[model samples]
Target: MPQPNDHRLFAVILGTNEIASAIALQLVRAGYCVVLSHDPDPPVIRRKMAFHDALFTDTAQLEDIVAERVDDGVQVYQALRRPPQVMVTWLGLLDLLPVRHIDLLIDARLQKRRVTPDLRRLARLTIGLGPGFSSDFNCDVAVETRPGKIGFVTDARWTDAADGVASSLGDVGAERFVYSQFAGRWHTPIEIGTRVYRDLVLGHLSGVPLLAPRDGILRGIVRDGSEVPAGVKLLEVDPRGRDAQWTGTDQRGRAIANAATAAVRLHAARRSTHRNPA
Candidate 1:
């Protein structure tokens, strides 16, 4: 983990969604400390959202959130209110917020295309698709394009691995709002959140491992552990539905029940080996 005083970078997720929370977790697991702030909107469920070290419901809690991380082992105070070198924009707030020190900006929603000009004008590194694709055009870092979603990095900043998606695929059947928002809407918030945390923000491959914890067929590795960084892909299961197929195993052809546990042990042992050399 990085020391709190090391010019620590952060991913300030603008919206109170899975994208924000996932990105924060990914960054923290990868050794970068994170501060997640969200003001609970009325009619919105207020479940405690855990990102990295600190979590809060109000902006006033921001300093305290960051402060707790400092005590635990994060050095983000070095930049004050300015976002660090790396930033993730899950929901729109880029224009409203200060960017004088933000080195890279990432737009996860893929809905706001107009923000790019302002982002570029600011000279902050950005990456995203154009207006024709999604709203996330103003990102300093973009990611893979998944028809309705765009993912990539600009100026070396990483993107969240999970793509933004609509819930209840086929439920909305071609409404203008659905089409404009790129809704086939198959993914649940938890699914997207898991992916963002494991892949993009963590700099891991898109094929990170996933355990079915039940009988299922194997899908390809979304992220192989060795090929990419810590927070890249693990693996993805087929979508749930009547037509969805199970591979009987996980991405690695391993039994799903033990995969998660094995992965943890393997990772811990690997780190232990590094720490205590024979």
Candidate 2:
């Protein structure tokens, strides 16, 4: 059980992808207690940017902050004692933890669907990201995640246009992405963040060579020993090489992070005013 602090707000972030990691980083910097919710066996391609990778490694660090995987609510309480800390847990145990203690719930799963009924009412403020969500019905706020309209926050009913295509980085969109051709366990020989040329053999999927589509830096890749299905994204290359690796939090992710932080502060202020009407 976490110690009660009327002045402190507790934020629970669902998912630990790039956008979610950015939001968690911002919220922690803003002095909110953050709990990063994730799956036990997360299939995160961008391992460097996702804190959910902590599930396998026991701990994953982003910039200066570190996320530690916890087994139960007691550990979560202990972790929260340190401000700007992150407690990682799966959904099942997450629901078992005390919900009343959560001040905000951010559904950053980017699952392209609405959250379940129980999640909508879990915290004082609930926020959903991307498509498949109606702000008026699914959550208190919805953050736009499409290419051009990224970072747009709304409280009214709104749905983003479904393009069903990944955002392109010049001609690098689909080409940069590497997928498994056969359904089986994937084995990668090249490490993430490594520089490679076009047609470079990265690894083997069901004994077939997984090659790079273009000359670029290996920015993101699935775990080496993950059981991958056919057509699953295996990795991605950044054609811009080392320059792209230095560029932190792509435009869309940074934009969404900014909006989410603003919304959190706005809601916090409203709650403060309601409690001690001046």
Clashing pairs in 2: none
Q: After superposition, how far is residue 120 of candidate 1 from its true place, in Å?
A: 4.2
Worst ten in a row by lDDT for model 1: 176-185
Q: Pick the candidate with the highest TM-score.
A: 2
Instruction: Give the Cα error of residue 41 in candidate 1, in Å.
Output: 11
Over 179-236, each residue of candidate 1 has an lDDT whose tens digit, in order, gives 1111111212132112222122222223322333222222223211222223222333
Candidate 2 runs further than 4 Å off: 1-8, 40-42, 91-96, 113-118, 181-183, 229-231, 246-248, 276-278
Model 2 poorest ten-residue lDDT run: 111-120
What lDDT does each candidate get?
A: 0.30, 0.74
Q: Report model 2's TM-score to 2 decimal places.
A: 0.86
**Winning candidate number (lDDT):** 2
Per-residue lDDT over 162-189 for candidate 2, one digit per residue giving the tens place of the 0 to 100 score: 5667787755678888877767887887
